[model samples]
Target: MYIDGALTDGQGRIDVINPATEDSVATVAAAGFADVERALAAARDAFPGWAATPIAERQRWMRRLRDEVIANEDDLRACVHHEMGKPWAQTEEDWDRVVASLDFYAEEIARLQDFSLPDRAGTHSHRMVWEPAGVAVAFLAWNFPLLNLAFKLGPAMAAGCPIIIRPSNETPISAYAIGELCAGIGLPRGVVQVLATETYAAADALSASTIPAVLTMIGSTETGKHVIRTGATSIKKYAMELGGNAPVLVFDDADLDLAADVVCGVKFSNAGQICVSPNRVYVQRSVLQAFTDRAVARARAARVGFDRDDDITTGPLINARAFDRIKGLVDRAVAEGATLLAGGDRPQGMNRGHFLAPTVLGDVTETMDVYRDETFGPIVSIIPFDTEDDLLRQANDCGQGGLTAYVFTRDLARAEGYAAALRYGEVQINGVKYDIDLPHGGIGYAGVGHDCSYLALHDYLVLKRITRARDTTLFESVNA
Candidate 1:
C-alpha cells in the first residue's frame, strides 16, 4: 500500500489471482482498520497544504506522475492483464486512459477561472470561485482497475484535493503499481494514498470517517448505496459512476453490419465486464433476423484465450464466481425460451480458466432475467420490437438507471428523435465514442455525477461566492 508518501506493508496480505490462469500473480498488502485510519488521517493532514499549492506547481506534479506512468507502462499493463485476465490488447485501453486522464485534467484545471456574477440591484460585486472540496475517498471497481482509478485520481489531483483510493481487492495490483509510481515521483504525503482491504470493516472505516468531504466511486449501485448509508456520518459530496444497463436500438433503416460489429466489439471486449456494455439490444422487427445473424457470426468469430500475441478479443471472466453467474444467466435465459444463437457455454478445450465464449441470445423477451438485469458478461440479449413507441418504452424501462444508449439508424430525424427520447447520460447515434475529455456519467440509479471532461472537476471542487459592496462615492465621482 502507498500511504503518507511511502510504500509500506499492511497487517495482512492479499494474494491476487490471474483469472485466466487461476494462478497467484502477486501478493499485495491489505489494510486493516488502523491502516485505514492512518490513510484518512494523512489525507486530512495534507488537504490544506495540497489545496493551497499553486496550480502551476500542481500541474507540474501531475505531469511528473504522467511521465512516470508512461515510463513504466509495460509493468502497469502487465499488472492489469494478469490481475483481471483482460486481453493484452484490452489492457492498452486501461493504460492509455491513465495517461490521457492526467494530461487532460492538468490542462483543464488551468482553464478554470472565477466567474463574475451580476448584482441585479448594482449595489455589490460578486464572484463565484472554485476551490478544492476537501479530503476525498475513492472506491474503484475491479473491471477496469487503472481506468477507474484514472477517472477519480486525475480530477481529484487536478482540483487540489487529497484523495485516498481504495481499489477492489480483485484488481489491486495495478492500482498498487500506480502507487509505486506516485512514490517514485515524490508526491506529497497523503496527497494520494492507494490501499486495498480484504475486510469490509476496514473499507467501511474510511467511509464512516468524518474527514472525507467528498466520497466518489466507480462500482455497482448496491455498493454505492451501502457507501452512502455508512458514510452518512458526514454530509459529503458524492460523485459515483454506478451500475448501468445500457440499451442499443437498431432501427430497420440502420446499417446491420455496423450495428453488429459495434455491439459485438463492445460486448465481447474484456469478456463483457463493462458497465456501459450494451445489455439489451432491441432491433426493429423487420430486420431482427438479419441483425441476429450478423451478431451471432461476430460472436463466433471472437478469439477467446490468454495469449498476448494471438490478437485475443475475449478473455476469462474475473473469477469462478463471475463465470458461474454468467453461465447461470445464459442457462436460465435459454430455459426461459431465449434461443442460444451462438456461443453460450465455456469454450471447448479451455477447461482451466473461467472462460466463457462470446454468447448471443435471440428471441429474448422483456420478462427474462437476462433482459431485465445487467448482464455483465460476454452475452448479448437481442429483443425484437415492432414499433418505435414500443422500442423506446422498452429501452427506457430499465430498472437500473441509464448510462449509455446506442442508436444505429441512417435517418437523421429518427436518430435525433431517439437521442432525445433515450433517458441516458450519453446517446450515441450510429456510433460509440468515449475519451478522457468526453463526459461519462449516468442518471437516476446509474450514478449521480460526471466522471470525464471538465464537468468532472466540479465533483472535486466547491464553489464559494464572494461579494463586496460597490464604492458609491468613487462611482459618482468617476461619473461626474
Candidate 2:
C-alpha cells in the first residue's frame, strides 16, 4: 500500500486466491482512515505543482507510464490469468486495452495543449484552461480490473491529478503489478497509488476528506449512489462507471449467424461478469428460431474450465457471491415463464470450482426476472420481437437506461433508425470493433455518463476563463 509518497502498512491484511483453483496468490494490506488521510494530504500538497507542470512535461511522464505497461505485458498477463480467471488467450487483448488507454491519454495531453477556446467577439480576451483537481479516489471491481482502472486513471494522470485506487480484493494482483510499474515509471511519488483491501475503508475515508475536490468511484449502481451522498459534504465531483444491463437487438433483417456469434463472444468474454456485456437479447420473430438454435450451439461449444487451462473460453464467476446471484437470477427467470433452451445447470465434473454451464433461454418476456435485471453471468435470455419498431420500443422500455445495444443488420436504413432511437451511450453495428476512444458509458440507472468519450478528460479537470483588458489604463481608470 502507498500513502504520502511512501509504502505504509495497514491495520489488517487479506489473502488473495484464485477462484478457479483456490490457490493462494498474494496478500494485500487493508488500510483504514489514517492511511487514506496520509495519501490525501500528499495529493493535496502535490496538486498545485502537478497542475502547474508544463503540458509537454506531463505528457512525457504519461508516455513513460505507457511504456512501462508495455514492458511488463507478460507479467500482467500471468497475474490476470491467476487472479481473474479469464482465459490466457484473453489476457493479451486485456493488456492491449491497457496500452490503448495509455495511448489515448498521450494523444489527449497533446490535444489539450493545442486546443483553443471560442473567443468572444469583442471586449476582454479569454482563454479556456483546464486545471487538475486535488485527489481522485478510484474503486475498481473484480472483472477487467486493469481495463476499467485505465479508463479513469489515464485521464486523471493526463490532467495532472494524484489518484488513490482500491482494487477489488478478489482480483488485485494484476492491479498491484501495474501499480508497481507505474511507480517504476516515476509518476511523482504520490501521483498514483493503489490500496488492495478487503473492506471499503480507504474509499470511505477518501469520500469524507476535507479537500475541496475529489472524484469518487467505480462500482455497482447502489455503491455509486452511496458515494455520491457521502461525498456531498465536500461537494466533490463524482465520476461513476456503475452497473449496466446492455441489451442486444437482433432485427428481422439481421444476419442471424453474425448476431449469434457476436452475442456469445460478448456475453462470455469475462464469464459474462462485465457490466456492459449483453444481458437481455431481443431477436425478431422471423429469424428467432434459427438464431436461438445457433446461439445455443455456440454457447455450448464454449470451453469452460480453470483459467490457467489452455483453450478455455470462459472461467468461474469472481467468487461464490456472484455465483449465487447468477444462480438465483436464472432460477427465478425460469420460474417466471422463461424456458431453458440448452443449459440451466451447474457444469458437470467441475465440483471444486464455481463453474456454471453456459445457459440460453427462450420464450423470455420483458416481465421475466432475467430480462428485468442485470445477470452478470453466462446465462442469456432471448426474447422475440415482431417488428424493429417494437424491438426498439421494448429495448428502451426499462427504467434502467444503462445499455450498449448491439444491432446486427445489413440494411443501412434499419441500422440508422435503431442507432438513432436506441438510448445507449455506445451502439455496435454489424461486427464493429470496440474503440476505446469512443464514449462508453450509459444513461439513467447505468451511470452518469462517465469515461466513454474524448471529452471525459474534462471530468478530471476544471476549466477557467482567464481574461485581460484590451487596455490596462482604461480598465484601471474604470475600476479605480
Candidate 3:
C-alpha cells in the first residue's frame, strides 16, 4: 500500500491465488489497524492544504497520474489477470475506461471553476463556491479493481479532495501497483493512499472514523447498508453502487436478432460477474422461443477453458466459493422446473479449475431465486411474458432495482413507453454501450448517489454561498 506518498509493508502476508490454476500467484501483506490509522491520519492532515491548492496545479498533478496509468497500462492489465482471473481483452477495456475517466477529470475541472454570482438588486453580492468534501474513503470491489478505483479517484482529485482507498482483499495486487505508480509520479503527500489490508477491518476503521467527510463504496446492498449505518456516526456523505438483477424487456414488435445480440454480449461478459449484468430476461411470448434459441446458440459458441485463450470469452470464477454458489443457483433453478436450455453442468475436460458452462434457462417464474437474486455468474434465465402489461409488471417486480435495463423494439412509441416505465437508472434503447459521459447508478435496492459523469465531482464537493451587503436592507441585520 502507498501511505502518505511513501512505500510501506504490512504486518503479515496473504496468498493471492489464481482462479484458473488455484496456484499461488503472489503473497501480499495485510495493512493492519496501525497502517489504516496512519493512512487516515495522513489524509486528514493534508486535506486543508491539498483542497486549497490551485485548481490548475491540481489538474497538472492529475494529468501526471493519468500519464503514469497510460505508461504502465500493460503492467496494470497483467496484474488484474494474474490476481483476479479476468481475461486479457476485458482488462484492456477496463484500462481504456480508466484512462478516459482520468481525462474526464482534467476536462471537467475547468468548467467547474466559475463561482461568482452578482447581486440581485445591487445591494448584496454572493460568492457561490464549491469546497472539496474533506478526506474521502473509497471501497473498491475486486471484479474491476482499477476501473472501479478510477470511478472514485478521478472525481475526487478533480474536486480537490484527498482520498483513502480500501481495495478488496481478493484483488490487492493491482491496488499495490497503482500505489507504486502514484508514488513514482510525485503526487503531493497524502493526496492518495491505498490500504493493503487482508480483511475488512481496515475498511471498517476508515468508514467509522470521523476524519473523512465523504465515503463511497462499490459492493452488495447489504454492505452498503452497513457502511451507511457506520458512516452516520460522523454524518459522512455517501456514494454507493451496489448490486443489481438487471432485466431485459423485449416486446412483440421488437427486432429479435438485435435483442439477441445485445443481451448475449452483456450476459456473458466478465463471466457474468458484472454488477449490472442482465440476469432476469423478460421477453414477450411472441418471440420467446426465438430469443431463447439464439441465446443458447451464443452460449455454446462462447469459449470457456482452464487456460487464458484470447479466443475464450469466459474466464473462471474468482474461486471455489463462487463456483459452488453459482452451480447451486443453476441446479436449483432447474429443479424448480425452469428449463435448462443450454448449459447445466461443468464443461468437459475442466475438472481442476473453477469453470462452469455458459448457461441459459427459459420458462422461468419471478418466484424462483434465480430470477429474484443477482446471479453473478455466466448464466441467464429467460422468462416469457404473455402480455405487454404483464411483462412490464414483472419487470417492475425486481426488488433490487436493477441498475441497467434493455428494450428492443421497432416501434418508437412502444420503446418510449417501456423506457419511461422501467425503474432502473439506465435503459439501453436497442444495444449496449458504456460511455464515460453518461451517469451510472441505481434506485430502490440498488442503493443511491451518482458514480459517473459530471455528477461524480459533485459527490466529492460541498457548496457554500457567501453574501455581503453593501448597505443595510429590509431583512438585513441592523445591529451588525
TM-score each candidate. 0.97, 0.93, 0.95
Better structure of 2 and 3 per lDDT: 3
Among all candidates shown, the one with the greatest lDDT: 1
Candidates in descending TM-score order = 1, 3, 2
Off by over 4 Å in 1: 472-480
Q: Rate the local accuracy (lDDT) of all candidates.
A: 0.93, 0.77, 0.84
lDDT of 2 by residue, 1-480 (tens): 766555657877879888777678778777676776677788788788877888788778888878888988889888888886778887777687778877888677668653345557766677777678667778787788787778877887788887887888887777777777766666687788887654675566677676737665567888888777777777677777777777888877788888888888878777888777888888878888999999899888988886455678888887878788888878887888788876676777788667778889898887777887878899878988876556667788756666577888789988888889888767889764666788767777667746745777877887777877667799789899
Which digits, one per residue and each the tens of the lDDT, describe model 3 over residues 1-480? Answer: 799989888875778897877888988767778888999899988999999999889888888888888999989998888887887878887677678888998789778864778876898778888889899999988888888888988899889899998888888888888888889988889999987676676668889899999999899988998888878778888898999888888777877888887787777778888987888888888888888888999999988863446787888888899989999988898899999888777788877678788999988887788888888898978988887657777787777476878888888988888899999888889888776777888987786788879988889999999987777564566655
- Find the 10 residues in a row with the least total lDDT in model 1: 384-393
Q: Whose lDDT is higher: candidate 1's or candidate 2's?
A: 1
